[model samples]
Target: MADPPDLAVVSQPADLTNAWLTAVLGAAVHGFSYERIGTGQVSDCYRIAVRYAPGSAGPASVILKVASADPTSRQTGAAMGLYDSEVRFYRELVPHLGSGPAPGCYHAAIDAGSGAFDLVLEDAAPAVAGDEIRGATVEQARRAVTELGRLHTLTAGRPSLIEAGWLERGSLLNAELLTQLYTLFLARYREYLSGPQRSVCDSLVTAFDHYLALMSAEQRGLVHGDYRLDNMLFGARESARSLTVVDWQGVMVGPALTDLAYFLGGALPADLRRAHYDELLLTYHAALGPEPARTPEQIREAVRRQSFMGVIMSIAASVVVERTDRGDELFLTILSRHCDHILDTGALPLLITGG
Candidate 1:
């Protein structure tokens, strides 16, 4: 109806006011206060506390996600069209998703030209964000993948979903781009990678095209491109949603097991994953409704084939996101874990042989 709030002003605490808040919320917002939250690299996030007028009805607080102010990160986000995808995801997809492990998006807007965007969403507070470095417990792992199944089940085999251009892998999945990316990733993180790990990545680079060629088109669905514990918020209190996944910037239409594989490879210790991954896989498979029937063996093969996802993500993520002590540590852990999983599952051989 009315024009969206200014992206620059809303992110500034000094400039936020009842008028702007009312426009965004579509209500009479009498007062509001906010504090920035999260260490998001591509976007600036804030938790806003609102005081509504007597007759007004809305949430007491909301989470606001805006494009990053950092020039490099902002430019990268713009180039990737990540902001547009997330805004579109909320506007077009969320309504169809029903209740699941995602937040209620009240308002989502994006300027295509500038690649600036904003999302006003339910604040899933008291739900602590999952820690990637520490990895998830078996119970948490089960919950994470099961919720992923719920997400995937809804869109699997749906024509509209499969056909959505913005939702599908664009330039990001291209072999040349990936080869270049892997080169940069290797150059940058070689010190952190072991000799065997480097060889695995080299094989991934060489076999990138063959790997993509092997993916079954029929198995495509909503893949949370960056699905991992760090992007998940696990509920700490009774009222909160168990797992509200955030960061849909990397969302794509691809083999669903890619998300499951990437997550499992990085979200658990190699030993714990070996001990419990089959059961977790069973949990995810059982949750999927029958329409897009998938056998456990077929799913296992998919997971193996897609195992390189975590490695690719580690390279891209480690380079793009602003570096921090915790960030580097987490990236290293992801690289190590994924490498171990690759070796454990004999995924490198599959990547080479395309079996």
Candidate 2:
């Protein structure tokens, strides 16, 4: 395969062309057009339909992800290293783990100097995106946890993965940044939070390092840093692939329980989660293999400690992203559910220090 064209500066729909698509996608594209899709905050996603010249040998359509045009969002993408990490993930890691929930990428490229990039991935349509506000059903939750186990187990304790500079965890949750972001979060969303909600946020923010340290002591693996219902696309009832996990920007190597807790925390409503918590944990553990690294009690504690993940994301993400009506509603949904989980699980007590 020839080196693909440099799309280091694709800022609009018109920048894409048949030649560029053909080179990267390894097929002849007679022509193509694109339409913006999704409510993505940090990047713009397009559904591109290709007009194949009869003998073209590539997919009919693919999803294209690029850095956002919005100034703040683009700057955030550049600063946070999201675009580079995602492009690297598709280029390096995805190939090793074949035929899974993640989408198939025909091409993944990043222009490191400009912090611009592109991803042409299998368009899993007729497969709808999951809604964070609506919450997930038990079956959907089951598939999500099972797939997550597969993701974690595939690279668990792999020295190469743990040592990769690009895959190493970033300072997104550093104490200083989290404290600053938490302050901004409280100020911006204070009107929407109840007393208990405010209290939990305050406790978590004050003890951020302590909580993070507790999680760091556990066994580690691949973590979908922002794992949740919203990042997934569900296939049709009869399709072989049940779910496709998207958004690799937040990829990191960390305790698997982080993803597990974050997913269950934001995904399920407080009541439904409470009822199925044990079953869901066991499901994930079973899929992780019989001799799991963490015991049931350890998993329970980690889940309890990490349940505040949604609250942290709700606070941090809302402040950074270009907010809209749906964004507000989605973040609020995560906040409400996560806050309730913390209170219900008595997680706040874990963050408190003795006098």
For residues 209-302, what per-residue lDDT tens digits would candidate 2 score against the true structure? 8877776776667777888888888888865478999898999877658888899888998899999999998888887787777777877887
Native-to-model Cα distance after best TM-score fit, residue 2 in candidate 2, in Å: 8.1
Best by lDDT: 2
- Give the least accurate 10-residue stretch of model 2, judged by summed lDDT: 1-10
RMSD of 1: 2.6
**After superposing candidate 2, which stretches have Cα over 4 Å from the reference?**
1-9, 157-159, 238-240, 353-355
Candidate 2 TM-score over all chains jointly: 0.93
TM-score of each: 0.91, 0.93
Clash counts per candidate, in order, are 0, 0
Q: In candidate 2, which residue pairs clash?
A: none
The local distance difference test score of each candidate is 0.80, 0.82
lDDT value, residue 190 of candidate 1: 76
Per residue, candidate 1 scores C-alpha lDDT tens digits across 1-355 of: 2336463334334556788778777789998888988877788888999999999988889988888888888888878878888888887777777777778887787766667677888888878778898899998899898898877777764567556777765437677877777777767677888898888888877877787777754367777788898888888768468888988877777776888999889999888999998899899888786654788898888888888888877777777766778877888899899999999888888776666
